[model samples]
Target: MLNTFSLVGINMGGLKISLLGSLMCIAVLPACVGLKPSVEEQVNARIEAYWQAMIQKDYEKAHGFLSPGFRLKVDKFVYRNRFAGKTSYKAAAVDGLSCEEERCQAAMILEYTVHGVPPYGFEFNRTEERKELWVNVEGEWWLLPKK
Candidate 1:
């Protein structure tokens, strides 16, 4: 036989667990319910995620972040060829960004390794600043290909 107690027909142990769960929910729900990421933050996150996919050589994942028009024009093969293995992106940080007219320009500092440089033909580390254009596509931000 199990040792059990109840209050108001609720098992004591189950009630305690339920109370803890309810309290945890009350404590956590506010943080998730009302706090929405600003456009800048969302776009910045997208930019960072894109670069992370690039760093991992996951071109397909990276391509999914591009605008529909861009994707329609540039297939996965072309996208892969355009960006694959040109440089190894070690890290990328969106240090500067601005949003206007439903579009965003993200200026990021990229730490990358380049291979086959002139003369030495050896790999080198370069930190470069680049800006990417992102556009709103059906309420989600997407990368726009430069024409």
Candidate 2:
């Protein structure tokens, strides 16, 4: 009973509505009915994601995990240079990750091997201490300064 152009317009409107509904579902589903992840969990996830990003040389993604103050002082190029390409530095393996909310300290040891002179294959393991701070801003925990 409908003319061809009218039918086409109706189909187009329906398609747009369907697309908007899909987008709204995707956007809102994760935000409802949850207490939201805790600070420690968020930090751990960020650290893991950061390491993965670093391993893949995804500097932009890795930079997101850094504190805002740190990010402001250091650019992406500087961050990449500091972390990438160390002849002495092999790879980092995280172990025994723990978080203390009261102390605001997340502890993890990076297992790594450094190349030695003459014999480059000599494997050695070292644990490096990393100190990270967590601050809450506007009800969201960020790995950044409070101010």
Candidate 3:
């Protein structure tokens, strides 16, 4: 008993089989070939965006980058006050990033100018290096709380 169809000289499920194979390849090929950027790259991009939000003095936007757990422990008001009018970055960079599964660690360098000083009466620039941890939550990457 033959239960298969043929089309255009192809057999055994014919166009249906061909279409299914094509869809399978489309779904799985990228994962096999590593077409997507490395996890580190993705983590670095998230870290960069987070810093950019801070540099722009958009505390509300920056707070969005924190992990759900961190947000639960620290509310918006506390987060905003932590950086409000006290920090301004001239430049920022992600020096390194490493990740395993949903967890990532990043080293970041920020060049910033502090705006007010009682003695100096003028802004002074400084460079600071810090390490940040990140987590992938619900398909989105977020910064973890600092230790």
- Candidate of highest TM-score: 1
Weakest 10 consecutive residues, lDDT, candidate 3?
1-10
Which runs of model 3 end up more than 4 angstroms from their true locations?
Answer: 1-36, 117-122
lDDT of 2 by residue, 65-132 (tens): 66666778877788776645442222332333344553234443343344343546564545465555
TM agreement with the true structure for every prediction: 0.71, 0.51, 0.67
- For residues 60-98, what per-residue lDDT tens digits would candidate 3 score against the true structure? 888999999899888888999876766576555555566
* Cα error of candidate 1 at position 27, Å: 11
lDDT of 1 at 90: 67
Which scores greater on TM-score, model 2 or model 3?
3
Better of 1 and 2 by lDDT: 1
lDDT of 1 by residue, 1-147 (tens): 000110111222212222342345346643336776567656755775687687777899999999999999998889898756566666665556778978998776667778755787888877777778999978999999785
The lDDT of each candidate is 0.66, 0.45, 0.64
Which sections of candidate 1 miss by over 4 Å? 1-33, 117-120
**Global local distance difference test of model 1:** 0.66
Q: By how many angstroms RMSD does model 1 differ from the true structure? A: 15.9
Worst 10 residues of 2 by lDDT: 1-10
